[model samples]
Target chain A: MCSTCGCGGEDASTRVTLVDGPQPHEHPHPHDHTHDHATRTVLLEQDILAKNDLLAAANRHRLAERGITAINLMSSPGSGKTTLLERTVTDLGDRRETLVIEGDQETWLDAERIRSTGRKVVQINTGAGCHLDAEMFGRGLTELAPPDGSLVFVENVGNLVCPALFDLGESARVVIISVTEGADKPAKYPYMFRTADLVLLNKVDLLPYVDFDVDLCLDLIRRLRPDVEMLAVSATRGDGLDAWQSWLADH
Target chain B: MHELAITESIVDAIVEKVGDGPVAAVRLEIGRLSGVVTDSIRFCFGLVAAGTGLDGARLDIDEPSGRAYCRDCRREFALDDPIMLCDCGSADLDILAGQELRIVSVEVR
Candidate 1:
């Protein structure tokens, strides 16, 4: 089990320790100082997510130094992300090294599914948090210890709204939306679509049975991100899997 | 929720800067287009700050309205939604403001 995040099984490949302890603050002066009685205003002028961003940059540098490619895969609940990952890993068997860092509010299921494919996988349970921050991703990277030139997919928690706000220092961000969901998802969740490097319209096999308008969904996503690359994929039915794999290789 | 994490981040930042000193108040500037709900943060602040130096600190927030520039109209206007569009019926908008999630100042005792 992961001793740090407390989310894993006994046979887990990696144990990721998340950031939950007190920060290491360096003090220039060790001497005792007198307390002031008057109230003082400290002008910070700092961005709220600056710390996260800095940590993400560090993570990016570390990954780059090791020649590792990290992909941040995100989507809402039941977007077939895990299934897609399983298929991707299975199809790329022995051809390339793939590792997964699975994030969920409360679950070992996704990680287990990925691990069953004989690939190294780690799970992160955020408890109540909606998104995986940079520090958490860093911890995951440390535990995974991915080999050089390996592909590490960080599967984010199932939430389109919050996950888009946090940068996990990945080489690319892939947002997946299934045909079972609304066609206006891009319009409703503009932030997710706006920040995506690639959009995967999954469950194309079920398109004929569903009411989802593929063209409309693509149009809405294009409206938000004019030149974002997109693909129609059926992770369950093996449709457009080659294109997805090629895209990954190209990236 | 993400707000809980954001609140924890705020407390962590404050403690890092002030070394657990008594914080009287914290001033923040949240933008309308930042995708964060101010009420959610306010609700999570007290809980996340309970054992920290900012336990009793007043959480003061300034919400900045979103502003964007329209390329077609060659004018700036307010934007309240993430689906940005200009008054001239153009989607080519350059956001000028409203994504600010900043910690402006902190009153320490």
Candidate 2:
């Protein structure tokens, strides 16, 4: 049994109403004996993410049919994800009706940052989970209610591990890595890189000051995800912002 | 740490799948590259399954090695590490498998 939060043999799981659906409920069934007490294995091949995946599929179809392009942004803590969004919002500035869904373990700080740009945004506090699931995205989509042809950016939790397992029904997944951090991040967190449609190598201005090797980083990222597109840019200096912006525009 | 949520998902799926019946055991297929901690999920499962029909149900985890296809060497191999280069020392590769996370069966008496 876990001593912390009593999560081992108790109801320590997080209770969240992030989606509009029937909540898991319990009903007493005395007919549990209908099996004649005979042991039988039920052939049920289902993904553990099946419930979440179904919601994600629905979200994907909904977004596509609505002509809304949603992007899932993932990275480790302090990867400058929010900073890039700030620039994107300010630069795009009326070009696209953008909405943001910020996921965090706790706090409304990221949402506040995006809010500073005067754009529509919502915050999701996982409280216990490490990543935001598709159900949460569905709820966010409903709450945001973005207009047709609008763009949405789902800023996932800071951690890279668990978020990769979840598909939030976004049009594309973008993983951001800063040169200030290890270049081998793609190697260490392969799932994140593998699932990403594009990788934004942020903070390129620090490349010279830092000892990060761009070639090595690209090679490592390719190993985990062949044919993954990458763009080197400094969110602070606005260097290479055109490519990043165009990437969004094209997508 | 997110294993708690993962376990909750497992409990929710099992409950919805088996209905209001006493589940005796559950068989799972966890790919080595699924990035899930089996032990943590096990611990969380015990906690989350207490009130459901899956209470006291034994969990059986089957591991599947991660599979990959190396384009440089034009060879396929099982990936134990994502950064692992091909036999030709090339990082050009495409992952083929080892990302599955699913339940294969559920036993009830």
Candidate 3:
């Protein structure tokens, strides 16, 4: 049995794979090399996410050099992330070149939705992965390759927890929550709210029909992130979309 | 869930440095506020480390408690999770520690 977590047992094997399926990131080579006979401790004092962070930094540099603006959109499963992207991409139109990178566990549905809006889109299926990390984002960036001074929207997988942990080197992060997701979400998922540069309270048109307290939700989000800018919008009805567009313009 | 991906990174990093040989052990420092579960990583290590130098290697983990400093009250306190609030009833706080996810060392044999 493992001492720390007691996870070791007969059923201990677990598979790790990339978006391409069973291919691991690195394969163990059969190269002959000398092994040290004596045991020696090598001090590495390196952050566990160092590789991801480095790739994210490189991605940031690449985007900056091309004068591109990237926004990472995160939310739960039914937060209207794809609907919002479709509207935003179509509305922006000729004003600014907009592209999208769609991430999901399985399916190109979101990518097809964006493509239908006449925007260049890249679909990344993470298979069993819950979030899109920097490595995957880097691959998407390479495929999309938005033009200079364009806006790139990365629609993250619909999960509030793990998406917040991985930085995709976006210019800003926007967390979208609809009226149906409850007001206490900011408190329940503080990390997601805390890391957001902006929060969008989507589906405002349904607020009158639902029991979502807008003021209380804003208050809770403010408690977690005092400096983050918050907005309300209904992607379907075009309500409060002018402000959302203006915010996008400013960025 | 994400621990499998994390464990893969850990194993790949150590193997890159030490080569595909019999490693003795690896040490990691995991903090409570890092959002990475130690138990999940432990469950994933052996499986992720299987065809590499880290196969059958002992895993040593050091857990650090969450610590935060309240900007409003100028006082330090312990935090159990990511809900950042000071004892002075202030939400404005700076986290000092407990977000670490670091590889401390590796013992090669």
Which residue pairs collide, candidate 1?
none
Tell me the docking grade of candidate 3. medium
Error of 1 at A105 (Å): 2.1
Give lDDT tens digits, candidate 1, residues B1-109. Answer: 6777778778887787667888878989889988889999999999999988899788899999999998778999989888877766777778888988877777777
**Model 2 CA deviation exceeding 4 Å by range:** A1-37, B71-74, B89-96
lDDT-better candidate, 2 vs 3: 3
lDDT of 2 by residue, A164-250 (tens): 988889999999999999988888888789888999999999987999989999988887777789999999999889998999999
Categorize the docking of model 2.
medium
lDDT of 1: 0.85
**DockQ (model 3, Cα):** 0.59
State which docking tier applies to candidate 1: medium
Write one digit per residue (lDDT tens) for candidate 1, span A15-38. 223224333222245547764345
On DockQ, the leading prediction is 2
Which regions of candidate 3 deviate over 4 angstroms? A1-38
Clashes of each: 0, 0, 0
Tell me which residue pairs clash in candidate 2: none
* True-structure Cα RMSD, model 2: 9.7
